[model samples]
Target: MAQQKVKRLPDADVEAIFGAFAAAEPEPKGELDYVNPFTLLVAVVLSAQATDAGVNKATKLLFQLADTPKKMVALGPAEIEDKIKTIGLFRNKAKNVFALSQQLIERFDSKVPESREALETLPGVGRKTANVVLNIAFKQPTIAVDTHLFRVANRTGLAPGDNPLKVEQGLLKIVPDQYLLHAHHWLILHGRYICKARKPDCWRCIISEWCRFEPKTPAPKGS
Candidate 1:
């Protein structure tokens, strides 16, 4: 089978696309709701390959029972699994959630680590999860590319690349410093709502003019 050619977007156009996206959704935020950094980390772990709504639904009750790392660890893996069984990979995720909470309580003095290296050392945490926690929890400037972002970057020609890492690097280089703080949330919201995977709402897209995607998807008829 022949490999598909990857698209390349102009830097200026990429900037404009993000600019318009930023203008439209000035203050975007993650869908996951948490009371603290520890809960945010746990929520992100449970969210892998799962919808935020689903995670929130599970966590809404779970967090109330075990919001802190110590409390979560005390809740145990089996208990965690029961609470988050609705999510995909709940068995493994439950194990990691319990183990990670124990690690936090024992290693980090019951606090979510601020550094990326420290954060990723936890059982369930990956680069993307660490980035989300670092940015949202610690207020650090980090972009964690998920499936939605990877697709949006390539589809919109915003930061076209073969993989999430390349797109992440591209965003890091081009994203305006002023917007860096909230860039992740903005891109995620755009990818989630506007520049979708199967079909993009090109007509209603505020950044359509800046997009480099050839033959953009047309607006739905009679809408």
Candidate 2:
């Protein structure tokens, strides 16, 4: 098999590229549906290795039953499991969800913690989940590099690194502070819709001009 060549981008160019992308689609948001920090945390936890569409499907019903820590704990693990049975790792997720809810009630007055360390202390919340909660819920400047963001960052030369943490740190270092709050959502939406995993629709991509990847998808015939 041939080695897949990766694209590289300079800090200034990367900023301009993302800036243009954002200008076109101003105000991007997470696809996952949620009401608050607690619901957002739960949704991100369930979203691991699952599509946003799938996670939203499960949470739509689950949220109705238990939207808050107090309500979630009352719903219990078994019921949570039953409601989210269709999702992957429902058993483990249910256990973590329940444990985290209990932890919230016991430790934080049933409120989602504001700090990263405190948030990560919950059963299922990890660095990525904490980052999402921090960025989306608290309006903090953070980038949560999931697979899509990782690939987009590397392939576009935006903030290339070997791992998600490094990429996230690089993004924080390079991305303009003014755009920090919504940068993650812009990259995620771009990666999901245009620079996809399988066949990136480069022809229609707005950033193709700035991309370092050679031989980008050609414009459709007779367009």
Q: Number of the top candidate by lDDT?
A: 2
> What lDDT, from 0 to 1, does candidate 1 have?
0.85
Candidate 1, 1-223: lDDT as tens digits: 1112445567777667667767777778899989999999999999999999999999998999999988998899899999999999999999999999999989999999999999999998999999999999999999999987877777666677888899899888878787888888887887788777667777877877876655677877888
lDDT values, one for every candidate = 0.85, 0.87
The C-alpha RMSD in Å for every predicted model, in order, reads: 2.1, 1.8
Query: How big is the positional error of residue 5 in model 2, measured in Å on the Cα after superposition?
Result: 5.2
Structural RMSD, model 2: 1.8
What's the distance in Å from true for residue 106, model 2? 0.7
| lDDT value, residue 141 of candidate 1 | 95
How does model 1 score by TM-score?
Answer: 0.94
Name the candidate that leads on TM-score: 2
True-vs-predicted CA distance for residue 197, candidate 1, Å: 1.1
